[model samples]
Target chain A: MPNQHLIEARGVTKVYQTKDGAVESLKPLDFSIREGEFISVVGPSGCGKSTLLKMVAGLLPVTAGTLELAGKPISGPQRDVGIVFQSSVLLAWRTVLDNILLQAEIRRMPKAEALAKARQLMSMAGLAGFEGKYPWQLSGGMQQRASICRALLHNPSVLLMDEPFGALDAMTRETMNLELQRIWSESKKTVLLITHSIPEAIFLSDRVMVMSERPGSIAAIYDIDLLRPRTLDMMGSPAFAVFAKKVRAHFYSQGTLDH
Target chain B: MLRRLLLLPALRPFLLIILLLVLWDLAIRIFKIPAYLIPRPEQVVQQLFAEWPRLLTESWKTTQATLGGFALTILIGIPLAMVIAYSKLVESYVYPLLVFSQSIPKVAIAPLFVVWFGFGIFPKIISAFLLGFFPVVVSTVMGFKSVEPDMIDLARSMGASRLQTFFKFSLPQALPAIFSGLKVSITLAVVGAVVGEFVGSNSGIGYVLQVANGNFDLPLMFAALVVLSTIGVLLFVAIDLIERLMIPWHASQRQVF
Candidate 1:
């Protein structure tokens, strides 16, 4: 049988050892992300949402508790997971296609297979004609799209994005939300997105995970009832507002001003 | 159409030079400066033609010494910068020593090189390297260090080995800064070669200038100066061209053409 849980976390916590003292960055957290599920973690800035994503990606370690992907503990950088940071972080030196092909280069994927896969991903991400352009030559949204293409090039089972569209403008962010839904469905990859925007969390994710202030722990997990192929108009519907309101209320309850 | 051609960016520098030469020729005629002091621009041109063979041979020597030193500097500087960029412990040990080396005037240290290595082209190359390598090391280290932590995180996320990360990501990221450092050092390398020749060389433009000084050959001295400046400018252009080739993607290189 296919694994029910692609990623499972049990009482995961992070405490950074600073010169001042041990600062708790994340509370003991228990969660599991199902295979092919789209999940968005919504919380205030510095609420350790990024810390959680980093742990999932195996870029950072948990101080306590177990974090697993495909039943293997996440100890270091994983070959099976891809991560996109808030910034696109495209290498200015490499062209769009070469930047995406970095995945193949690092993973030692075959050249022909990797190139074909990259070409398809580029078209899916609406970056079809920008294969040769450098990062600086592209717009903010296009650059982020190229980075997203890079993350997906390896065909990882899970894509961990830490506010991938956070740097984009409102209009571009809306357009990207639609593009992401299409890509996620077409790619059939489980996604764990971290974002502060309530609408973004609700619009993109199958479930929106709300977190409390630093020493961040799960405040609530709301299942998004919206239909598949979620359109921008659906985001304007009452159902979307209700989810947005619920996620927003968690922040107000904590008296944390950060969004 | 001619006015537009003169205003063309590539041609502008030459136009300013020609205009300056005319003003210089006028000043010499109006002031009636003696030939021993400031020769007329035409007199310097005449001397340039007269001494072309000798000047070409000496210039070739200086060019070899300067280039040999510069090549050595780049060879040593970039790898040293890489070592220091990645390790703070090594940096603390090496950075201060580099500063101390730079603190000693290279001109003052010229005689010591002659004493140690004798008055061969080797001493001149050594002098050029000593003077030129420091900026290259400093700027390249700064370049490597300036890379975004996010870029590195991205690399590591993909399972990029540390060596792969540096060569593919960090090295190219640092190229612009490295090239700027090289441009500055190339000019200094020329000066260092001249200093080496000053300390006891019987060849190069420096030796030619010294000989011209003794004989009161002002035009020859002017010719030598022109050759030195020409060498410096040409080397700078060469580095700039290399930078353009190496990093056409870089924003700085975009508008430069």
Candidate 2:
């Protein structure tokens, strides 16, 4: 059988040395992500879900075991990955266009190409006319969209999102979920998303990996059997409800997940 | 029509100044106050014209000292702040020293600067630097530190070097705060320069004040005060304008009007 895995992790663990002593965060996480697959990790607040995401992004070092991308060990910040943080994190001083172009600038991409690509992404994100506007000028959803545009500007192979829409209101979050699904299908990149909401995880992911509480290990992994190009209407369908119930069961069994 | 024109933001301050000057002249006349106490606005304006050449030269001298010290404050203070922000060790060792340096009054230190550097523009610059740099260091440090660690992580994810992360990420975010510090520092720099001049100097507006007081030239002293205040207001406005230019996207610089 052909190995379609684009990202591989074997016995990966994270131990944070706090002032109190060694704090175990993740206990030997073992998972693999295939190319062009959308994977979402759902867990309780202190379940080291974010810790695992950061590790995959190569922002935080894994304390032990192996984490590999394309057969190469991820030793440091991986240039092939794009990250979307919570809170939008848009620079207040830059215009929407410049803010999106910031990633290209950091990578020393050719200015003209970057500008063109930034404009294209802006239009795709429905921010075409607002290029000259600042972050403060845009609505919360718009600012987050611009940040998403920024993450995709450099065309990284993998997109890692850590609760990117957690700050948005309910109505906006639903719309963003739809847009994100479209973006993922069009971009054809491997995606790893960390989230708290079971419905969101099920709606966005090919496989939802549920993690347990502190010193988190994968509690269960469910492969969604729903048909693709899924619609918001499909969310009420039997297959979707089954996935949602299965993910929610983990949270209810492991105590509250209000986090 | 005249009232409507004066209501414009640009003309409002001038309108207020004129109103105050008229009120001042009326009060002096009605109270039958002596010229020696608070010179009439007309008499002060007359004195200002008569002392125009002297006031011009003195103001130029004060301006040079203020700008010099302010330039020094920015050059030294910002880098010093960056150093402290970049390292916890440096901040631990230097932050206390900074606080201690600020504790000893700058006005008291001015006389010492005169004694060391003599009664030259150098002492005035030194005094202004001492007074102005503290605020810059404090504000710039705050600005740099306020950057979200996630912002830095994002930069690192893009392969941004430390220097790149600072200039490209931290610097722009910190600019509004840094500009605020500059505004405060510039005003303090004028006071600092004047303090140095008062401690020991033959030129500058402060020196002119002393000479006018010695002869009891109240009108001339009032004229000097006007000149000194004009310099302070102009420099503060200059820094404010530059902030608008540099960080137009800043919340403080956002368009409300």
Candidate 3:
């Protein structure tokens, strides 16, 4: 029997109308995310990686072709999908718990249940003492952790992350990777992360989808045979190097390696 | 240390006022300037105490008009900003008129308001509303426009309804900016009320200043001026306190010691 696909994209494309005329953002592309799978898309800046993710999240309209989540055609924002943007984007006026609870409040979830889930996600994200603190008080990495917890608060099946750790320093990025992997393992939610860093993409994803510059289309997809519970050690190993090389070769072919 | 820290901001301004008063007293004594030319700070204080009953009543009248106009500005300006911020069509229609109104000096319209509404507080309140309304509208429109696009996308992605997106994200995000407008407009509200009184009112601190000016009673003029400034300061502080309560999470509200 065929494996269950949670997210399906069939010849999806995006075109933006501008003062300079029509701009093709994403070329016709097809892909599917299996149930509880972790997928990452790596590409250069301005290569429509973000546009593709936004389309999938139903935040942006797909200009052409078909995209579906579960069995339904995605015409607008869906209830069972959550998104994490490049920045933490936590509201400065709200405490961490309040920011996380934003998702619950939007969905109109029961207050008692939402509060319980918020506390659980906070502790899981290692943000126990910081719940009542404002977002500005948390460091870059901690803020992003709280953002992830916020995305997961509603228990959505699909979590779409767009360069979630791109703002952090290298050392913080690595720690956040481990934290994310731990969260993913525990939650078993389908995640599609968009990133610029090759190693960051390979370290977190089950399969890495590489795309070309401008009018971005999938150039290649590599399935990682690396073991579960991936760590910093795995990034230094020979096997990880091989996967990184493959993802890099696509950027080289497109001559976008400089980006 | 804590007490010093708490009191220093208040203390510095108070000390400066005292030093200025001392300087003024010395200048008057050393130069032997006539009281009619410039009343010493003590004479102004004495005048304020001697005419306390009349001064208090006039100050109260100005205060009522200022507050009434400010309350009206909040009611009208915010909704006007909402309409302008949300719809480009409405903005194009309304924004030019707003700019045009500003071009005509609000003080020039104060007497017209008196002619239309008679010598009542209605003209004073209207003048205050006119002066206060523009800053509120402009600042609020700017605040509404400044909401980060990513924040809007985040709200939309969460399956938030249009109203939910506004209440949860847009309104809260615009709050600090809105408070900034309120702070500016509250001070202007006092000026508006005073301008109306200057033009034609028989009561209010502004009218007191006018009578003192005609009589060349410098001490009384100084006292009325002090009362006007006091009202401006108190209104500004009230709005500031409200801002602190409303948006303590804002970076501006974070106290550093």
Highest DockQ, which number? Answer: 3
TM-score of chain B of 3: 0.94
CA deviation > 4 Å runs, candidate 1: A1-3, A256-259, B255-257
What are the TM-scores, per candidate, against the unseen true structure?
0.95, 0.95, 0.95
- Give me the displacement of residue B6 in model 3, in angstroms: 12
* Root-mean-square deviation per candidate: 2.1, 2.3, 2.3
Clashing residue pair totals per candidate (backbone < 3 A): 0, 0, 0
Highest-lDDT candidate: 3
Candidate 1 local lDDT, B164-253, one digit each (tens): 998888988999999999999999999999999998899999999999988998999999999999999999999998989998878887
What are the per-model DockQ values? 0.81, 0.82, 0.85
Q: Per-residue lDDT for A1-259 in model 2, tens only?
A: 2338989999999999999999999999899999999999999899998889899989999999999998899999988899999888888877889899999999999999999999988888889999998888889999989988988889998999999999999999989999999889888879999998888899989999999999899999999878888888998999888788878887777466542
Candidate 2 docking category? high
Question: DockQ score of candidate 3?
Answer: 0.85
* Pairs with backbone N, CA or C atoms under 3 Å apart (clashes), candidate 1: none
lDDT of 1 at A25: 97
